[model samples]
Target: MPTAAFTTLGCKVNQYETQKILESFEAQGFEIVPFDSPADVYVVNTCSVTQSAEAKSRQTIRRAARQNPNAIVVMTGCYAQFTLRRGETLAEAHLVVPNPDKLRTVEYVLEHFPHLKAQLEQARQRGETPVRRRSRAVLKIQDGCNIYCSFCSIPYTRPVMRSVPYQDVLEEARAMVADGYREIVLTGVLIGDYGAATGSGGPDLAELCAMLTAIEGLERLRISSIEPTQVTDHLIELTATNPKMCPHFHIPLQSGDSRVLKAMNRPYDQAFYLELIQRIRARIPNCAISTDIMVGFPGEDEAAFQNTCKVVEQVEFCRAHLFRYSPRPDTPAEAMRDQVPEPVKSERIQQLQQVAKAAARRYAARFIGTTERVLVESRSKLSGLMTGTSDHYLQVEFAASPSLAGQLVHVRITDLTPDGVLGELVALQ
Candidate 1:
């Protein structure tokens, strides 16, 4: 059988796209292998979210090429799209698929690599079953972002706004559930901006979640990441009340300073962001609020940086993704004055990371001794305990059998780990 390996970088949206692309290849009789292993083909879903991301994407492509010198290396995603848009090419990529047509990457592969097509045809001709392994699925219900945050390249790359039809989304969710996936994370570029704008005759994001929860066998539904402005009150209430909807919110607060937020062209101010989070917590006690924080934006003085630290302390996020501000080509922030020195950015990153870590630990400490429903995902490499995410998005681990990998079980929080909470199995829920 023809072998192929896949790797994904960047956001949940990229992960979802990679899954779909992999499924397409599987249907064509490609044997999936680990990225480290030698394979007939390699696919890297690249990201260009930041300069570092672009560098990592390139490095991944080169590594895939080195993994199998003769293997066909396929690159697709934001980085690939950016390179192609500039009339440049990645030397390591044998076949570069653009982001706009990423879902059809398998087709592009077949068109570019004919020997693999023959291998797939021969495998199918011999009547072999396609390999399929999935426990948690990511369903992208929306795509494209219109909110042009100055430091982000997503708007330039995915300028259009589109929402997947309600019927199509429901069908996919039902199919995934039937396929034995206990969890489905709804992902999109701007997921909260679902419906109306794209002419999809569908309900809004909250209503869509309500519809998705009705799918039998779907034990968990997660909203990957949402903008602060787009997270409506209705959505908060639904998440607070709905058992199917995971009690986790990944709202990106790029910067906590209002001046920095304005510089980034984010709509809401720091006060608005804080108040929104407060409202969410008020409705849902102990709900996990995760966020993305971009540090060292242009013109961010000590006062502005301190303002961000204050917000981090106040919000006490369950998780915080800290990013150093990287200038993207053609963005307004690229030309802004008072660009923070690398030394200053590094220092601020350390400071913010310490604050964020402390806040996360404090938030997690509250749940110790309480039982939470956890979907066992994998065995922890360090602790040898089965680790999975709880209903509130907290990472909880406990001693359990391998057979319970996909089931939802109760875990009583026992102790606090550096990154998450350790727990013991209470009972199956």
Candidate 2:
């Protein structure tokens, strides 16, 4: 049997797609090996989310090539998608299948090693194991993005908003639940904008939440990252009522200044975002509201940057991802004249990041002495510690063994650290 290795980079959507590809390869009797291991084939799943991500993708591809110089090197994902659109030469891969139908790619690999066909057939007939082990299973309910935010490269790399059929989503959810996964994070390029396309008379995110909550044995369902504009009243209401849904909202607030937001083509402004956050807190008390902020956007002046800082301080988010604006090729922001200097952008990112860290510490402090339900994910690599996530997505660490990996237990928050919450595990009940 021909051995193959795969490496993936970037978002949960990419990770989910890579998992599907891996399953397909496994079914074809391809012995899955580590990326560092020499193999007959190596697949590098690329990412173009940021310049760093693209650089990493190229680095991984080169590393894979070095591992097995004679092997067939295949590269796909966002970087390949963007490069192909630009008519750029993809020299790394022997067969550059640019976003080829995933299943077809697997079949192409199988054809080269026909002797493994009988084993592949047997594996397919037997089916995958029911109880698979995973700390967190990403369930991609949607794919692609429609709204072309000026600063984003996603719409170009993953154009259009396409939702997985509701029935298919339910089936996948059920499967994950049956596989002993305690937490299923609903992920996508544009998760909140799910069901907007296709016009299939399917349920919106609120309905999807309700449906998933009804599924028996599923301990938690988390919304990966949602847009501020997509935080509908219905969705907020559903989250308020749904016991299974995590009380953590990560809404992307690219900029606080309306002018900056308009330049970036983001759908919501500070006032609108604040209102949404207020509503969510009003309904779901103790909810950890988080956000994504982009500093030094095109046309962002001192006032605009200060405006973003003010909003961040005012909102006092539980946590925030602060990013310095990096213009992607073919995006509107790249064409704009008033791009901030690198030093200034970096300084502002640091300032905002400090504020976010402070907010996170404050949020974690509130949970000190409170008991929370946490699903133990893994034994900590540090020492005899075990780590897990609380219902509100706060990381909790305590002493545990490998046997408690998949169990949900109540933990009393004893200390608040900069990195995570230190907890004492209560009875396993």
Candidate 3:
């Protein structure tokens, strides 16, 4: 059988698209292999979220080429669009699929490389359809982002706003549940903008979640990442009260400084963000609130950086994805005055990371001695012990049978680890 390899970068949206693309290739009798292994074809779902991401994307493409010089290297995703915008050509990429047309990458590859199609036709394919591994499956229900955050390039790359039809979403969710996935994470560029951008003409995000919980085999539902402005009371209540909903919220607080927020054209202020968190905690006790924080934005002085540190201490996020701001070409923030030096950005990131880690520890410590529900994923690469994510987003590791990999079980949090907490198996839930 013809072999294929794939890798994805950036966000969950890219991952969902890559999964769909992989499914398409497998349906065409392609034998999927590891990206590092030599294959007849290689697809790199690239990201241009930051300059570093772009560099990594390019490096990944080059690595694919080195793996098999004769292989067809395909590049699709945000960085693909960025490459075209920069008027640059990647010699290693034989097929450069457009970002918006990423889902159709397999078709582009098959059509261009007829020999691979002929090879697949000659060999008998034995794969009994590829099952998405483990328990959690990401379902992309919405596409395109219109928020246009000044520091962000996603809106530029994915300008169209469209929600997957409710029926289609329901069908996919049912199929995922049937495929033995216990948890479904709903992902999108701006997921909270589900109905508004171009109107789904059906259920909004909260209503969609309500509909999804009806799927019999789906043990959990999670909203990957949402903006602070989009968390409505109805959604909060559903997440707090719904038995199937994971009590973890990934709301991106790009910057905690009100001045930096305004400069970045964010709608909410510091007070509004803090108030929102307060309301969330009031409704859902011990809910894990995770976030993405960007450091060293233009004009983010010591006072502004301290303001961000204060919010990190205040919210006590379960996890915070701390990244330094990098100027995307043609973005508003790129031309802004007083761009913090790289040294300052690095220092602030280190400082913020320390504060964020402390806050996360404080958040995780609350669950010590409490029995939390976890969908046992797999063994830890570092600890070699069974590790899985708790309902509240803690990575709980404990001694367990390999047979219990995909089941929802209870783990009694015994003590804290550096990342999360070491736990003991309580009972299967």
TM per candidate comes to 0.88, 0.80, 0.86
Q: Can you write out model 1's per-residue Cα lDDT over 1-429, one digit (the tens) per residue? A: 898899999999889989889888887889877687899989999988887788899999999999799999999998898899899887889998988899998999899878888888888889887655556789998989988999887788788899999999999999988887899999999998998668456699999999999888888899999999888888988998888988899999988899899989999999999999888889988789999999899999999999999999999999998888899889889999999999999999999999999999999999998999998877777888888889888888789996787788999998899889999898996
- Candidate 1 lDDT trough over 10 residues, lowest sum: 127-136
Candidate 3, which segments miss by more than 4 Å at Cα?
1-6, 28-43, 59-74, 84-97, 107-134
Model 3: per-residue lDDT, tens digit, 1-429?
A: 778998998888888888788878877878777676789999999988887788889999999999899999999998998798778999999989988888899889889988887777777544334333457888998888887889987788679999998888999999988878899999998899887346676788999999999899899999999989999999999998899999889998988999999999998999999999999999999889999999999999999999999999999999998878999878999999999999999999999999999999999999998999999987776787898999999999999986788889999999999999999998998
What is candidate 1's local distance difference test score?
Answer: 0.89
**What CA root-mean-square deviation does each model show from the true structure?**
2.9, 4.5, 3.3
lDDT measured at residue 245 in model 2 versus the true structure, 0 to 100: 83
| lDDT digits (tens) for residues 1-429 of candidate 2 | 567788888777777777778767765567776576898788778887777678788888888878888888877887877778888765666655566554356766557545446655665577632223355577888878878999887788678668888888889989878867777888887888777455324888888888887889887888989988888888887778877888888888888898999889988777998888788889988788878788888889989888888887777777777767788878898999988998898788888888778777777888999999898876665645888888887889998776787788899999976677999988784
Taken over the whole model, the C-alpha lDDT of each candidate is: 0.89, 0.79, 0.89
**Residue-level lDDT for 157 in candidate 2:** 65
What's the residue-level lDDT of 260 in candidate 1?
A: 90
